[model samples]
Target: MIAVGRIFRIQQELDCVALYFDRFESFSSTQVTSQVGLSYDSRISRLQWTDFAEAIPKLCCKTLADIPLIDDSAYVRELLQHAVMDDLLGPANGPNELIKDMSVRDRYLVGKLAPRETLDEGNDWGNSAVDEAEDVVPDDLEVKAKPAPPTAGKRTKGGEQPKDDEALGKGEPETSDEIDVSKNQSLVPSSFGITFCVDGEAERIEVEARWGRYERIHDHGITKTRKNKNKKTGKEEEIEVKVWQRIPCGGKMVLDLKQGPVSRRSPD
Candidate 1:
């Protein structure tokens, strides 16, 4: 019965190949899956075997011996490994009779196959072996010298500028309007309560300006127009004018403390 179970499980593993191929051909087309009404996740689970098969081709396997099998069962892995080795060694002579005729019951009773151990021990041993091999270098070997520091006034290999001299070069003065325009260029204008004209239709928008403590509103010159009567003809005509006022400064006066005045001059 034990021998029979092993053979049955081996046959089931072989049958998985055909099942996987069918799924690969089915879900390979996006239009077909949509027409057949299958969700993407459901289709993915059905085609996992295909992924394993595709990985084998990338390994450039030339013979059955080159194929890799990652099976959970130790018995299944041993059976597959023996079958592949036999095929590569003697392709003309069919399957190895030794493996085919062996009884799983007799093997278990005689303890020919040891119990499987956890993979953690094997992995730790491999890491320790690598560390031991790397430590074998001679201690007397000379080590390479470290690189020298970069000199001043010389550019680095990456062409990065020095941080200490960023303001050494002359640059154009920046205005408040230019700075504000550049900061808002990347954002969507609609989010800022702004609108744009479309198809020759005008759009009305209102904007508020805010200033920090060191910032002030600049006053550009203003112009105004008014209608006036001509002095001689008594005819009204439009005249353009610009106007501004100046205030007297009280600080400009200087007092003469030592002078004594007794005469007053008449107005001339």
Candidate 2:
């Protein structure tokens, strides 16, 4: 009797969630693992950690319009993080439904991974932003506007501003020299980009990194016991329980030796 009573007492203090019907609960990160979910994107197959880097090339791909840049690391991270099915919001205090309800499994898998990388080129661009900016500082360390080419008379030495130099534009403080120039760029913009692409393995590694023993996302969710109607007992009682849930998943895991945490050498 003492041992049984002690067990109950201990459980009463630990966190647990009430599994109520009709409540769309957030997926239990504690219950989830890398062993479940979908991978390979076979449209029929699912994995806990999908290897999109390996899968995209097998499918026919096409480029639509090109963005001047993917922006930067934060932008890419945002694009990956928010690529989910839906919010499926409920009453303010109620559970969120869209979180785990992957009606469209394919979208869910790809959206979960965004299946992209931390490219060497992008990293170089980011580093170069800092490096190149140093070189662009004026000889005296202040960027004073060079007087506009002598108001369009016969072109004078150093006064012939190119049509593309927006520094000549009224009220513009930055000059073209201060901006980054892409190798193949024909047209220049006022701002620059510092970003690179990475490989699939790096991304996958990032997803599997521990938020905790079994928890992912923000933090571990521990619940306090609460009084509720017990279906089995048909009476009001205090109940508390912790649950870990995971769906089974499968995919071929490969490694990109040239990139990610496993790389032996980086591109020169």
What's the TM-score of each model vs. the native? 0.13, 0.14
**What lDDT, from 0 to 1, does candidate 2 have?**
0.30
For model 2, the stretches where C-alpha displacement exceeds 4 angstroms are 1-213, 216-233, 243-268
| C-alpha positional error of residue 51 in candidate 1 after TM-score superposition, expressed in Å | 22
- Model 2, C-alpha of 124: deviation from truth (Å): 32
User: How far in Å is the alpha carbon of 202 misplaced in model 1?
Assistant: 79
Top model by TM-score, which number? 2
Given candidate 2, what's the lDDT at residue 170? Answer: 43
lDDT of 1 by residue, 78-115 (tens): 65665564344321122211212222222122211111
CA-RMSD of model 2: 27.1
